[model samples]
Target chain A: MLKDITLGQYYRADSVIHRLDPRTKIVGTLVYMISLFLFNNLICYVFAAVFLTFVVGLSKIPPKFMFRGMRSVLFLLVFTVIYNIFLSTGTVIVKFWVFTITYEGIQQAVCMLIRLFLLIVGSSLMTLTTTPNQLTDGLESLFKPLKIFKVPVHEMAMMMSIALRFIPILMEETDRIMKAQIARGADLENRNIFIRVKSLIPILVPLFVSAFRRAGDLALAMEARCYHGGEGRTRMKAMSFSAGDIVAWVILAGYIFAVVFLGVTFKTFPEFLVLEMKAGLEYLIPTLSAR
Target chain B: MDIEVRNLTYEYDSGTPQAVRAVDDVSLTIPGGQFVGIVGHTGSGKSTLVQLIDGLLKPTAGSVYLDGEDIASRKFDRKHMRSLIGIVFQYPEYQLFETTILKDVCFGPLNMGLKQEEAVNAATDALLRLGIPRESFGASPFEISGGQKRRVAIAGVLAMNPKILILDEPTAGLDPGGREEVLGLLKSLNESGLTIILVSHSMEDVAKYVDRILVMNEGKIFMDGNGKEVFSHVEQLEEIGLAAPEVAYLMKAVHDAGIPVATNITTAEEACGEILRALKN
Candidate 1:
């Protein structure tokens, strides 16, 4: 049951998306998030959707698997849509005793839901295709420019990579400790919720203690290896941007431009113009009817 | 409580691309009141087999019968089953978090649904039996020595009043004196009619304490018999990266040196006596 959790899960596949430099993927994800918010029209949404679909297909990552990432934040997405529909005010389409449902409210709610869903899917695409080590390496290299500010960029990347490496180890340890407690007749499941929460104290305290102990040991080991930040440290595998990376960047940039252009020209400007024309027509229609 | 594993098979990461068969189809009977020692190198399925018996792991196929009842049956109470078969995992002392030794020991019986008074009584009795002082019961478990901490952990399991007890590498990382003390405690527990299953790397301890030895290799049972019978196949044991009991090795060496000594000797005391008799002759 614990194994099904896909937080920081990476799917191994030999595809162009998987082969792109981790640095490229990270930057691409940031740009994709920006483009998702830039699109306000249905046409722009369609363009973004089709682009994501093509990337997902090229990555060979199943669409069903990508959707699984949405399951965790599914409740939040629902909450956002429901709140937007009820609270947003515009031209009322349906009116009750005190509440009004507007046409624009429905539109805003749908757009908000789509935006949140796309954000999760796009970020998940980055994590699914990149290994934790590679991601950290990319972050360190990207942050190399911050050396001017002395931000300890390399140390931060090293720490992240180490944390990722120890996740499985800690998981296995937790499993063992949980079983040990169970053997001692600790009924973690059968107790009342309050008692269950209290019982976790026993498990959590030891887990934290051991984690700190491991961290201390790891620090000492790293020190013994003469690890003094990333200064003068040469990497075993050099990061190189290949032809696939360049093509990926080009396609992503083109897709973002199209989404932004369509959103502005078709959705925002047309909606503004239509509202203005509606006001003018309202006055003309009343006069014509009077005549 | 006897544990009967019938056609038991387990696969790690089942249904995943990285799936591996850790425990292949196997059948074994661990009779009530018998002390069985399981020995294997790392990744030999010995640990997996023990976890199956204790129900820490559910087999992918087949069933585990505890005293003629299928443990995997929906009607079975898992907590009750676990209480009945107490398991002391390797280096289990690391799990100790209770403020006092008594409270830590009482944790198990309380989980078994005993009243606070009854749990305290059981914990007291267990600590006393394990040679911990009544005064030490009130002290923090963390304040004790490593050996004392280990005994406290074992006493924690003992407090549950299990009919069958399983220990994984109980003697690991212990000094010779501490090892003997812990093994002796287990031997006494076995003598009192509690079925014991011990998984360990120390062939000497197993030969000295257990009635039978099970040799595991590559997720399959390689051999299962009385200590003398299992240790007699010196060549096979060594082939699988396991050494026979030192007494058995000494006996075999003496026999091969043209002495008429028996090669199946398992205990050090018996080997000493036999060597004395051979010298006199």
Candidate 2:
């Protein structure tokens, strides 16, 4: 069951997005995420959705596979939506039992949910299409200017690549350790949360120990092969911008310009939908009170 | 307890494009007190089949029956399965976590809801049976040798007093002497009427110990028989990138060289006796 995690996992596909430079995808994701928070109107969100769908389509990743990453953030999504719906102050549309639902509150919650959803999907697309090694190479090349300020950009990128590589290894180890503990009759599925957490001690201690051991062995192997940091290191697949990357950047720029332009021109939800929601609530609340 | 798997199929990453049938429509009945060895090349679904039987993985189709009761049925007590069938995964020694060897072994029985004294007694008995000394009981599991750590891990499962034990590559990464010791221990355990299923690639080990051998290839049971019967199809085994024991190959060469010895010898002792009888004739 632990294998269901799709976060930070690369999906292999022969597609335009998969072959694009990792730097382009990474930068495009950042631009898309920033644009998501820059706009709150329904029109901009629709535009962003169109953009996200187009990119995801080009990536050739199955919609189901892409959405599986949403499961991890589902709890946060629900909490944020619920929190926004209750707390945002605005014109009240329905008041029932101490809970007030406002038009503005509904609008804000919808916008936030869309923002979070788009943000997760846009970023996940980057990770899903780009391999870890390519990502590190792209990042190191992108941050090459930081070397002038004495920053260990290459080392940091190497560490990130290693950490990313270890995610699946550690997950498999945790799974094995969990099964071993369960085979020994460890009650990991206890209903009590505290007991469940306590039972995790058996799984965690070994996971951490093995992770450390693996890290040590990896370090020794790297050293044995004369890996003395990323200095003087040459990449087999050098990071170079391609025509597809340029096209990706151009599309990202257009998306950002559209989101910003629309966000500036329209500061709130469209007026007619708000009027219709008020009318609907006005007709519904009195009938409920009459009952 | 005898285990029966009926049309058991498991798919990893099910419902996705990358879904693969790890165990495909396998049906097998393992009677109680049988020493069965499952031999296959890597990625042939041996591990997946064992995990499915252990209930670690829910089959995409079919059911597993323990002593004629469907273990996956809602009314079946899953805890009873956990306490009855023990699984020792490959590199089991890496699962050790407790501060002391005794406490680590005690983790199982205590989890089974045994009282403190009873758990300790079970743990001590298991450790002693695994040939761990009394003085080492209080030592940290990390302080032990690799083989000792493996024994402690096995003791951890044995303390649960499981009737059936499944080991996946129990002798992997061990020296020849340690491999023999572990396999010998398993043989003795099997002789004591505890059902054992060993998953190993070593044909020699399988021929030396197990009564029944199941050869898996690409998620299917390619061959199922006793060692001699399975090894007799040496060409078929080789076609699957597997082989019979080295002695079986040697005996085949001897028979081809016009010796009157049998070509189906699967173990060293059998090969030696067959060769001697041929020479005597």
Candidate 3:
């Protein structure tokens, strides 16, 4: 049951997005995320959503698969939405109990949820399309200039790739240990909060020990093969910018341009759509409350 | 405590593009008190099959019946049934986490809702039966040798008082002596009427112990019979990347060398007796 983690996992496919240079995908994710925070209005999100949908379609990964990845961050999404709705001060739309629901608060909540959703899914898309090795190669290339300042870019990239590789392995180990304990009558599904928390001790302790043992074995194996840092290492599959990468960059630039243009041209949505939405909500809320 | 698997199938990562049919449609019935060994190449679904039987995994397209009741049915007490079937996973020694060996062994009985005193007694009995010395029970599990730690892990499951014990590669990383110790212990456990389903990659190990053998290939039970029946088809077993026990090959060599001995000898001891008789003749 623990195998549902999709974040940081690459989905193999022969698609335009998957074929793009990892550097292009990484930079595109960063720029796209920055664009989400660049504008405060819903019109920008319309463009953002269209772009994400187009990229998601081009990536060839199943929409269901992408949404499944969102399950891990669902709690954070709900928490942030609730936090914005109750905490922000504005013209109060409804006041009940100790809580005040403001028009501006609801607006902020919607915007925040959309922003967080787009940000997470956008970044996750990048990882989903790119292998961990490709990601490390991209990071190493991007950080190559940092080496001029005495930074260990290669070492950091190597460590990151190793860590990413271990994630699935460790998850598999955790699942095995959990089943073993369960077979021995470990009651992981106890309703009591304290007992449930305490039940994790069996899983966590064994997972940690096995992880450390694996790490030690890996280190020894690497040393035996004379893996003495990335200084003199040569790449077997060197990263190169293909024609698809250029097309990706151009699409990203166009997306940024469109978002900025919309943000400048319309502070919020166009007047008519907003009025129509408000009218629609005015007619919708009361019948629901009457029921 | 008999297991009846009816058209059982399992898929890993179901509903995903990467879904793999780990266990295809399989039907087998293992009676109570049977010593069965499941042999397959790696990824042939031996482990998955055992887990499905243990109810650790829900089958995608079939049902497992424990004592004539569908284990996956809602009304069935699956948790209680699970407690009756102990599964010692591969590298079970990694499951030990308690401060002391005795406490670790006590985890199983305690989780089964046994009283503290009763749990301690069961744990002590299991440990002693597994050949763990008394003084070592108070020591940290980490301080024990690898084989002892594995035995303690097995003892932990034994403490739960399971009627059926399913072990997946229980002797995987042990020395030859340790492997013999574990297999011998399992043999005696089977003698005591506990159904033991041993999943192993070693043909020699399975042939030496289990009364019945199931040869799995590509998620299907390719062969099912006693050792003599299964090992007799040495050519077919080799086609699926498996083999008869090494002694069977030795016997085959002996038979091919003009001796009138049978080539179906599975164990070294049996091969010895047959060879001595043939030489005397």
The reply for model 1, stretches above 4 Å from the true place, is: A60-65, A89-107, A257-269, A272-291, B234-241, B246-261, B270-281
Model 3, runs deviating above 4 Å = A40-43, A75-111, A266-291, B279-281
Per-candidate TM vs. native? 0.87, 0.92, 0.90
Clashing pairs in 3: none
Interface RMSD for all numbered candidates: 1.1, 0.8, 1.0
TM-score of 2: 0.92
lDDT tens per residue, model 2, A18-88: 99988887788888887776655788889899988988998899998999899998987896577667755
**In model 2, which runs have C-alpha deviations exceeding 4 angstroms?**
A96-99, A257-291
User: What TM-score number comes out for model 1?
Assistant: 0.87
> Per model, how many backbone clashes are there?
0, 0, 0
* Winner by lDDT: 3
TM-score of chain B of each: 0.97, 0.99, 0.98
Q: What's the CA RMSD for each of the models? A: 7.0, 5.6, 5.4
User: What docking tier does model 3 reach?
Assistant: high
Model 1 lDDT tens row, A1-291 = 456656578988899999999999999999989887655666777777787888889999877678767788888788666665665567888887777887766777776677777788889999999999999999998998998997989889988999999998788788888989977767678558988998887788778877888999999998899888777889899999999999988987787677767867785556734543343344346546756
Give me the displacement of residue B66 in model 1, in angstroms: 1.9
